[model samples]
Target chain A: MHKIWAVVRREFVERVRTKWFWVSAILGPVLFAGIIVFQIVQSMGGAVRNVAVVDSTTDKLGPKVIEALDASGSFRATLAAAGPGVIDSLSNLVESKQLNGFLIITDDLVQTGRAEYQASNLGMQTIESLQRTLGKLVVKARLEQRGVNPGVVDWAQIRIALDQKKISHGKAVSDSATQSFFMAYFMAILLFMAILLYGVNVMSSVLEEKTTRIIEVLVSSIRPFQLMLGKILGAGSVSFFQFVIWGVSARVLLSLRGPIARALGADPASVQTMVLPHIPAATLAVFIAFFLGGFLLYSAMFAAVGAMSSNEQEARQAQQPVTYLLMVSYLSILGLTNDPSSTFARTLSLVPFTTPIATPVRWTAGSMPTWELAASLVILAIGIVAVTWVYRVGILMTGKRPTVKELVRWVRTA
Target chain B: MPEPVVVDRVTKRFSGHTAVENGAGKTTTLRMIMDIYEPDAGSIRLFDQVGGGRIHSARIGYLPEERGLYPRMRVLDVLVFLAEAKGVSRRAARVKALEWLERLGLADWRLRKVSDLSKGMQQKVQFISTILHDPDLVILDEPFSGLDPVNSQVLRDTVVDYRHRGKTVLFSTHIMEHAEKLCDRLCIIARGKKLIDGTLAEVKHTHGGKHVIVEFDGTQGNARQIFADRQLVAKLQDFGQQAELELATGADAQEILKALVNSGARLARFELASPSLHKIFVDLVGPEAATAAASGARGANGGANA
Candidate 1:
């Protein structure tokens, strides 16, 4: 055990001292902050578009449309009389960048609910908002024409906001669907990237020893199994440390969202809508359990790949199968998150290869039975044990990369 | 006293390949004694313990034929880590590592990365790591294959120093002179078989008989006819000015001396002596096998120097 600890300390200290570790660790939080700042800036909106309402209707509906568009605060609208030269003039204005777009309102708009919008270029959000405002005006105008009170029509058109809440243990929690989905997505990506990145790190470390011929000296002193286990645990600790840094920084950033938003000249309330989801203790436990389990499971296979390969180019080529296995689990994440209770999702969550990322994502996206998580962990543990056996034999092997048949033989014989 | 190690008829095969085809089984046998590889047919006993596994790892120091160290690691740190892995305490390992570094003229390079040092320096560092924990037994495979004369002498002295301290040192080398100069006991293995093994004196006594060293005037060409008399000489290793001859069965060494003088070759010295290890090795393994081993050693030295 003490010898194993020595190997662990050497692996950890050697890796942690590299500049690559700190750069990548800090890069994660910097990327997160960049995304947050971008979203806030987007929500504050761009310069209002200058557009004209072209009226060809006999009832002068263009004025009302212009008034509604102006009130929406996304467009600065002007009333223009429809004439033969009116469109040509607006086209020149749009071409010269003086006009963002122009909406043409005609008698056919009320009849067919169709209108032509012309512009040099317009954002999707701008077009959608314009359509909503025009639709509402047409509906109200039609209601008044039917002798319905304008006040009643306006009152009936008030938007009703839907409140989303998730129920846990027979209590409805105030976690919005968007918030829950965002959290699940975030956690899945974090787990996937961390596992893949650090698992490859383990592989390179093993390859470094093998190519450098250091394994001979090492195995003479300690058991190969001890050396392998020490390496996995050491690298796992580095990934865990990185995750903690990212998590704490994320929390700190989320709490400072108000100040950051205000500094960007965005409404603080708009930023507040993006609250950090409240993660239960059980969910956090599952996250950590799956992270560690997945890290061990994949890193063992990676270490074996490193051991079997005799050089860097060979290692890169040999690690593809293991990489593809992790990718399959990651690719299934979107499907699992969408329907966490589906048979496909449940089966994937139970399989050891996919369980590490799948189970945690399913738990966060939907309600998962406690028994399923436990069973998944058990299966993952078995996977790790089996891979570790392969790793033990592989680390001492040199020369040609082994085929899958050889790898199986190693597991059985070792 | 119990033997430190006994590799009893050990056999290890890699798939369909014979382990000893290229003389690589020397390293393989050492690896088995270290428990890095398990023997299929026989057992290895370390310090009189059967099936001891790696329990004796801390007691046995091994320097593999393929020399390497962690390139990114500091010189002192790599030594300390290796010693610690051998079950030495960190504090004691550090002190010993420092002392060894200072003794090896590497005290100023203790903090430098292994890759930054010269090949000879790296080799010295590896040698230090091997015996850093002060093991009871030190096994080195081809330890002097890649060292410059200066570093080689330093290592040779350190190996001899270990012997003076009453530590057991078993090392293999393709250079017969190295083995001849340093070994108390010798084992010659070839073609997956032990050709001979015993104390140096015993090996010499058993394998030595009717050997004659003749130094004469003129080149070997001048005495070719005298050596070509197979009736008198069984084998001849011509060294230009001197030749070592093994007498044919019942031929008598005095007969060869008379034949040489009769041929008008001026003989400066003629003496009978036990066969040198190089002569014995060439005779036992044949000229071809001996040349192969020597060339392999040269290739390794060239690679290291390059």
Candidate 2:
């Protein structure tokens, strides 16, 4: 245990002090800060303007169109010299400051049963509002022509808002759901990058020793299992420490940006007592377990792969399959966030290859089952054990790639 | 204070190939000495405890052929860690690591990263890691490869120092010179077979037995004939100008010189050569384990071997 700890300490210090650790660590938060502000500014941006119209519809729809649009006050359409549907010549009219957008009704509008809408979507929102107003006018006109009363029409097509509310089982994903959503992903992506790279660190280290024939010297004192565990744990701790610091820094930044409530898109006005998502102690425990399981599972494979090669290049090439597995887990997490409880999502959260990221994601989203969480953890535990077995086989491999048949033979017979 | 180690036919086999196929490969093989290896095939006796597992806790120090040191770890920390792993008390390990560093002229590197050190310096750290616990037997396999002449000399001096402290040092190296200089006795093997094991002189005399090579420089136009006339000459060869003859039991240098000078020949150079390790290698291990391994497959040959 002490030996393992010694190894872990060295690994953690080495990784944390590296420039790459910080570069990746800060990249997520900076991008988050920049993106949130960018989005918020963009979402709130728009011009308050009125849209004009020149309907030349043969339906002969009158002031009912004007009255319906007037009630909304969002659009001000006028009867103009130019006739029906979209005003195709608005380039000239808009240039002359006649309108922000226009609809021109064609003479065959009723017969054709289609209307044309056009506008500069950029530099104004006038066209969008006008489109909505035009849609309403067309509907009302059709209803009235069929002798339908406007009151009954409004009642039949009444707008109902289904305000959704959920009780969070855990804290980490609650106050920071928006933050958690982005954060869990950020944490996961960073972890993916770190694990993939750090795992290769362990691999490259092993390969270097093997190539130089230093592995013999090392193995005499420490068992092969110890060496593998030491390296994987060490590098994993480094990756973990890096994210913890980054996560804390991000939370600080989030709070400084007004409040996490505002940051996560909770209505800024409705947020009287702003509370960030609470990272429950239980969730933290789960994360630690997942992180350890994930790092070890991958690190062991890397060590095993590294043992197969006598040089860094081959080790790197050998580690590719595992790196790809990490990538798959990352993509799966994205899928999970799309709908954390979905069948595909839940399955990914259970497999050893994808569970590290997927499980934590579903856990945060309050979408995973207790049984599923335990099962995933158990599978990951088993995965780590398998990593050790493979690593031992990899190191003793005498200058040959361990094919499936060879591996089975070595495991079963050796 | 502990009794010497004893290894009894300890054989380590991987897949079907065996490394360290027998206890005779180790000099600690004195019956009272304990051999350290896994129980399946080998037996070891260390002090009153006799077992077939790896050397117990901290009694023996080992420097495997592959140097194992954390690259990023401080030189002191690595030595101390290795020392502690060998079961030294914490304070003692620290004290010893520092003492070894100072003795090796590396005290200034106490806090420096092992990776930043020169290869030889890193090798020093490994050496300290092995001997810091001060065990009776130090099992080193090619522990001196990366060292410069000075460091090698330092390591050799340290080994000598360890011996003076009554500690036994048993290490393997393809460089026969290190073995010849360091090992009081050794066992030479080739292709998983022990060809010779004894004092240097005895082994040389046993397999590549010592032979007398007398070189007499002269106008040797009739060198072959001159040697032929002398029945006391066991064998004769000429290297362009100088004629070298192997003396049979009855022939001595004085008598051969007396015969040469009486025949009106003046000797330019005359000397005797002893059998070297290179000759023993060619004769015993059959050219491969010694020659090929020393030069080419410099791979795992020195390691994973008895």
Q: Using Cα atoms with residue i matched to residue i, what is each candidate's TM-score against the true structure?
A: 0.88, 0.74
> For model 1, how does the per-residue alpha-carbon lDDT over B208-251 read when each residue is reduced to its tens digit?
76899999766333378878888888999988788999988889
Number of backbone collisions per candidate: 0, 30
Where is model 2 more than 4 Å wrong at Cα? Answer: A47-118, A122-137, A159-194, A197-201, A259-292, A324-378, A396-398, B1-4, B12-20, B23-40, B44-135, B143-147, B174-177, B200-254, B260-306
- Model 1 bad stretches (over 4 Å): A45-56, A62-67, A70-100, A118-121, A147-180, A244-270, A365-371, B17-24, B51-53, B219-222, B228-231, B249-252, B291-306
TM-score, prediction 2: 0.74
TM-score of chain A of each: 0.86, 0.69
The TM-score measured for candidate 1 stands at 0.88
List pairs with backbone clashes in candidate 1.
none
- Residue B89, candidate 1: alpha-carbon lDDT: 95
